[model samples]
Target: MLNIPLMSNNISEEDKEVLADFIRTSDRFTNGPKVREFEEAWSQWLGVKHSLFVNSGASANYMTMAVLRELYGPGEVIVPPIAWSSDISSVFAAGFTPVFVDVDMSTLAMNEDEILSHITDRTRAVLLTHVLGLNGLSQRLLDELDRRGIPLIEDVCESHGTTMNGKKCGTFGLASNFSFYYAHHMSTIEGGVICTNNDRVYQMCRMFRSHGMVRELTDEDMKREYAEKYPDLRPEFLFAVPGYNMRGTELNAVLGLNQLKRLDGNNARRVENFKLYVKNLDPEKYFTDFRMDGQVNYAFIVLLRQASREKFERLTELLRSENVEFRRGTAGGGNLARQPFVRKRLPDFDPSTLKNTDFIHFYGLYTGNYPSLEKEKILELCKLLNRV
Candidate 1:
């Protein structure tokens, strides 16, 4: 009779008051100065040169890939089977073929070996997601990708404040995406951001966020150059690239700026909560050996050590009987490689090679792990799970 839901309402009364104040006082509700302010603050927080606020995390994914395609042209994007649908969809949307790779059991990220093996002349970029706030990056992966001059695009929507080598996850890649959706590390009602150190990538993302308008370009010199290149068209109305309108509103920006202030503190609590969960879990029955050096997981990832259909079903049944909410297959519902969209593209794609992803697809489940989750509740949940 626990009745534990996956996530609690994280938006606070103070947050609502701020929104109400903004609504009462501010006339400009569209994408404007507030959005830019949030973007700059986010960039500073993530240690990136620039950031672009988008309507949603999916838009952030598509914007990142679209900018990548614009800068590097169409080719293959190496991706993990255990990722969000948008991560794969964005690649296809940008006219790049997705080369699937098996994820590591420990990190739930693209296996470094699998990624390295898939690289070819056609390899464009590696779209890596830091699933559920777990750091999906490695120094070797960074060094290898850097050596080959292959851009690493990180999808860190579920992860905020997770780090590797003292540097944040979003700062490692050519461009990275973050979401400020409900129950995440932070909330902007519904918003996302694209972070990058590269100037060209930043400029492209700015244009892409707002219908590819040259006016969106921040660098005055770039704007003038574009204006001069297309003398026939109005400089303010010029469409630099085939971009979509994925801009975040001023209201979203207001919420983001407020939530961002406490993000780091909340993430710290989440990290500790995850560690406690792993420590208390029955290791013989569950896979509790995740790479936890600098992770701030937003959810408690539970995976069976062995593939037993009975165990998996029993675990689900127990959780439901106890009114504990959970989702099977972890992030994005297990192996995205087996999803119909992927099958349509790569008809002969083999699932055998993706043993880790396949196992997770059938045996893994993630429960709620918000900052406010009680330690006693977590301990109780583990006790129930151990019985399975």
Candidate 2:
């Protein structure tokens, strides 16, 4: 039913050949040398000291939060209303209360003032997501968090090449998460990574990625200390933390390594695609003044400027007739507070408080934007929407 789907496979035939060759030659297939190589490459690319490869971005989220909880103890975490479920789920799982903050309409990130205002003595970290490849970070926000001594954990699952102040979004945070799902900037079939500069956090994450074994720690001295501390248990079998088997395989790493080479080039194309998209869309009828600097948009966000049930319905009808696939309530299904998961936990939660988030929930939708997308098609889609 869809002529223009939400996502097209970015994985190339060359990537497959590399994987095939690896499979034919390598004896190891599980979490081994290739995975470590990919992790190192990703760390270098992201400008972080260490990276831990995991099964999914959701696992990266959970592991980062788990490590944070182990190191910082239980506390509240400031979160954005328009974020992936894993960002909040990781917080809840880490035994931290999620304090919601409304988003800035322009950037689609948590308002800097709102996030700062919600900070309390109990607040442990601010888990911010660069929604749909938009850089959801600012200099003032970083400075304020640093001044308050609160860690800033970034959920960069959707934003791979997005930057702020000439540095990648993930590099600025205490720890950041990335996804390599098929639809993302890159693909490993299914994989994710956690990047950090903190040595202790890096070591802990390495252990957590496997079965929390001392053997997983890269530092020899730390492994020795753990071994000395626990004599009864075997050094290799000693579990420092109750960690899950969230390890990624060598095959995924192989795909990732191949994809990594083309990431920058592909991202450049996406940036251009988004620019062309906003250039033609009718600004009066739709909102197009998004913060575009340092952005590599994942999709073309079509948000109505004013609330009109007639316009919304007509827009959907036109898209359907044209067979252009899209997702409404773009980015984290709009306001997360309105979701049953949040409401069931906090019965008093109100969605109206997050005005910008709620507006997007009702009126916004995102269509696919990938590297190979045709320019003429983009113009045609904009023209169709402008008519609506």
RMSD of each: 1.0, 1.3
**How big is the RMSD of model 1?**
1.0
Model 1 lDDT vs. the true structure? 0.91
TM-score of each: 0.98, 0.98
Tens-place lDDT digits, model 1, residues 1-388: 7677899898999899999999999999999999989988998899988888998999999999999899888899999888889999999999999999999889999999999999999999999999898899999989999999999999999989988977889999999999888868999988899998899998998899888999988899999999999999999799999999998899999999899888888998999999999999999999998999889888999999999999999999999999999999999999998899888988988866798999999999999998888989989988998999
Q: Per-residue error at 320 for model 2, in Å?
A: 0.7
Number of the top-ranking candidate, with TM-score as the measure: 1
Clash totals, every prediction = 0, 0
Instruction: Give Cα distance to truth, residue 269, candidate 1, Å.
Output: 1.3
Error of 1 at 20 (Å): 0.3
